[model samples]
Target: MHVFLIAALSADGFIAKTVDQISTRWTSKEDAAFFAQKTKEAGVVVMGRTTFETIGRPLPDRKTFVYTTRELLGFPPELVEATQLPPAELLAKLEAEGYTQVAICGGSQVYTKWMQSGLIDKIYLTIEPVFFGTGIRLFTEEITNTIRLKERHLLSDQTTVLEYEVLR
Candidate 1:
C-alpha cells in the first residue's frame, strides 16, 4: 500500500491556525476542486480524530477512516467508518483488506507520527501565498530524510502545488 500526505499549508508551513480550527483563508475554491479530484481518485482516506472533528463529517463517496484511540460515538449512521487503531496495525489491516492507495489527511501530530514511521510514500503540499505568524505546524519534529520533488503545478492565484516522493 502507498501512503500519501495531502494538505494545504501557509507559506510558513502551518497547516491550521490552531489545533481546533481549519485554515479557511488558505483554502481556496481551486484548492477545494483539486482536493475533490484527489479524493475521488483515492480508495481510502485516513485522518486523526481531531481532523475528523474539525471537519464535522465524513466526505461522501469515499471510504473514510478516522484514527483515534478513543471510542467514536454519536456520529451519523454510515457517515464514515471510524476506527481507533495504531498506524502500523491500521495500515496492515487496510492492506490486508486490499486497499492500494491511502491518503493521510491531517492536523499536525498525525502527520508527524506517520512520517516518523516512514510509511508515507508521497506528499501533496499546497503552498498558500500568505504567512501566518502563529499557528499549528504540519509536523512537530524535524525530518532528516530527503524528499524529492516529483511534480509541481501553479494555481491561478499564485498558490503552488508541490508533489514530493519520500526517499527511503
Candidate 2:
C-alpha cells in the first residue's frame, strides 16, 4: 500500500494544541481545502482514536479506519471501522482488499508509529502562517530519514503546501 500523510501544522510544527483539538479551528482555509481534496482522492483514510473523535464523524463516500487499542462507542460500525491491528497488518489487509492509496491522518502517536514502521510513502504538509508557542507536535518520535521535495504551492492567505517523498 502507498501510504501518504496529510497535515496542517503551525510554523513551529505543531499539529494541535491538544488531543481533542478541532484542527480546522486553527488551520487555514487553504489547508482545509487541500486536505479535503486529498482525503477525497484517497482510497482509505486512517487515523487514531483521538483524531477520529476530534473529527466527530466519518468522512462521506470513503472507508475510514480508526486505529485504537480499545473499542470506541457512539458511532455505528458502518460509519467507521475500529481496528487494533498494527500498521503492517492494517496495510496488508488493505492491500488484500485492493486499496491503492492510504491517507494517514493523525494524532501524533499514530503518525510516529507508522513512520517508525516505515509505512509512510509521502507527506503533504500545509504550513500555516501562525505559531503555537507550545502544543502537540507533528511527530514526537525521532525520524532520521530524508525526504525529497516533490512539489511546493503557495496558497492564498500566505499558506504554503509542501509535498515530499520519503526516502526509504
Q: Pick the candidate with the highest TM-score.
A: 2
Clashing pairs in 2: none
Error of model 1, residue 38, in angstroms: 1.4
Angstrom error of the Cα, residue 88, model 1: value is 2.6
User: Taking the tens digit of each residue's C-alpha lDDT, what string does model 2 give over 1-168?
Assistant: 679988888899899977888899988877887887888787579999899889889888678899888877777676689988889999998899888888999879888888888879899989988888889998987988679999998888589999999998
User: Where in model 1 is the C-alpha error above 4 Å?
Assistant: 76-79
Q: What is the C-alpha lDDT of each candidate?
A: 0.82, 0.86
- Give the lowest summed-lDDT range of ten residues in model 2: 70-79
Model 1 C-alpha lDDT per residue in residues 122-158, reported as the tens digit of each score: 9999988778799888898987667999999787667
Please give the lDDT score at residue 35 for candidate 1.
Answer: 76
The RMSD of every model to the true structure, in order and in angstroms, is 1.8, 1.3
* Candidate 2 residue-wise lDDT at 48: 92
TM-scores of all candidate predictions against the true structure? 0.90, 0.94
